[model samples]
Each structure stands twice: as C-alpha cells, then as structure tokens.
Target: MTHSEMITVLSQRLRWPEEKVSELLSVATEVIGDQLSEPGTLSLPGLGNFTSRKSKEFISLHPETGERYLIPPSIDLFFRVAPALKKQFEEREEE
Candidate 1:
C-alpha cells in the first residue's frame, strides 16, 4: 500500500493519530536504513530477514562491441521471507 494508506490503516488499528503513525514509520525506515548501511542483518519474526552483503568487483564484456568494462564492488541489500509467511502465501495460492 501507499504511505498514506498504510498510515491510515495503522492509525485506525492502533488508535493513534495519523501524524504519530507517520513519524513512527519514518523513524523505523531511518533505523532500518542505518542498520543496513553497517552491513548488518535485521530479523523480524513472522516477516523476514533483511541483510546487506558486499559484492566483489568483476569485469564485464560487451558481446556486440567486444568491449571490456570494470564493475566496481558494491553493497547489496536482500530479503529472505520467513517460513511462516511463505507458507501462508502457498496456502492462499492453493485456494
């Protein structure tokens, strides 16, 4: 859902003001970003695991032009779904 839609849903469910939910989401986003930048992992139960890994530099070749390029190493973020969440999707698909 969109940010506003999420805020509305969370506000209604938690009985909190939209402004408060917005701020909470903003803070959570910032915290997640900061943790990922440290090349760390964050695991939330029933959700998934978030991780950051550094990729090694590599060389790439252009098939058509026969040109070679150097690719710089970078940090990549990944998410692995929790088993329970995956199972829920599988059951939904079977229905």
Candidate 2:
C-alpha cells in the first residue's frame, strides 16, 4: 500500500490520530534514510534488512538503437525479507 494508505490503516488499527501516525512515520523514515546514507545496514527484527551498495561503472546498450554507452557508478538500495517474515507469508499463501 501507499504511504497514505499505510497511515490510514495504522490509524485505524492502533486507534491513533492520522497526524500522530504521520509524524511517527516521517520520523521513522528519516531515521532509516539517515542510517542508509551512512552506508550501513538497518535491520528490523522479524521484518527485513535495508542496505545500500555501490555499483561500479559499466557499459550499457541502448535497447532501441543497440548503441553502447557508459553508465556511471551509483549507489543502490536493497531489501531482504527476514526468514520469519517470509515464512509467515508463505503460510498465509498456503491457507
């Protein structure tokens, strides 16, 4: 779900005001972003991991023209689902 949708759900489930939920969400996201910017991994228990990786410069091909080009190095973010979380989802799917 989208951020607004998530906030709405949390507001209803926790009986919290939307404004409060929004503020908490904002703070949480900001903290996560800060940690990732530090080039570190942020792990959430029973959830997943958030990490960043720096990719080396590489050559690329234009799909339309098949022309070759150089792609600059960049940092990329990734997420890996926790095993417990994955198991819970798999169990739900089986049901």
Candidate 3:
C-alpha cells in the first residue's frame, strides 16, 4: 500500500493522530534504511528478516538487437518470510 494509506490504517488501528503516525512511519523507514547500510540482518520476529548483499555483475542480451550488454552489480535487499506467515498464505491458497 501507499504511504498515505499505511498512515491512515495505523492511525485508525492505534488511535493516534495521522500526523504523529506519519512522523513515526518516516522515522521508522529512515532507521531501517540506516541499519541496512551496514552488513547485518534486521529481524522482526513475526514478519521476516531484512538484509543486503552485493550482487554479481552479469551480461544481459538485448532482445531487439541481439546485442550483449554488461549489467553493473548493485546491493540486493532480501526478505525471507517467517515460516508461520508463509504457512498462513499457503493454507489460504488451498481453499
């Protein structure tokens, strides 16, 4: 969902002012980003872990021209869903 929608949901759920929720959301996002800049994993028990690592540079084939091009490497962010959360989605899909 978009940031505004998230703020609205949090405000309603927490009974907090929209402005306060917005500020908290902004701070939380900035903190998460700052933490990820270093090499480490940030874990939220019921959600998942967030981590980053350098990706290997690779060559890509241009479909239109059949020409090969080099794709530069960059930091890759990863999130592995918690087992419980994955199971919930899987069970729902079975219905």
List pairs with backbone clashes in candidate 2. none
Model 3: lDDT to the true structure: 0.88
Model 1, 1-95: lDDT tens digits are: 98799899999999999999999899999988888887778999999999999888999999999999999998899999999999998888542
lDDT digits (tens) for residues 1-95 of candidate 2: 99899999999999999999999989989988877876668899999999888788999989999999999988789999999998898888542
Candidate 3 lDDT over residue span 18-85, tens digit each = 99999988898999998887767889888999988878899999899999999998777899899888
lDDT score for candidate 2 against the true structure? 0.90
- Best-matching candidate per lDDT: 1
Top TM-score prediction, candidate number: 1
Answer with 1 or 2, whichever has the higher TM-score: 1
Q: In model 2, which runs have C-alpha deviations exceeding 4 angstroms? A: 56-73, 93-95
Return the candidate ranking by TM-score, descending.
Answer: 1, 3, 2
TM-score for all models, in order of appearance: 0.81, 0.72, 0.72
Which regions of candidate 3 are displaced past 4 Å?
55-74, 93-95
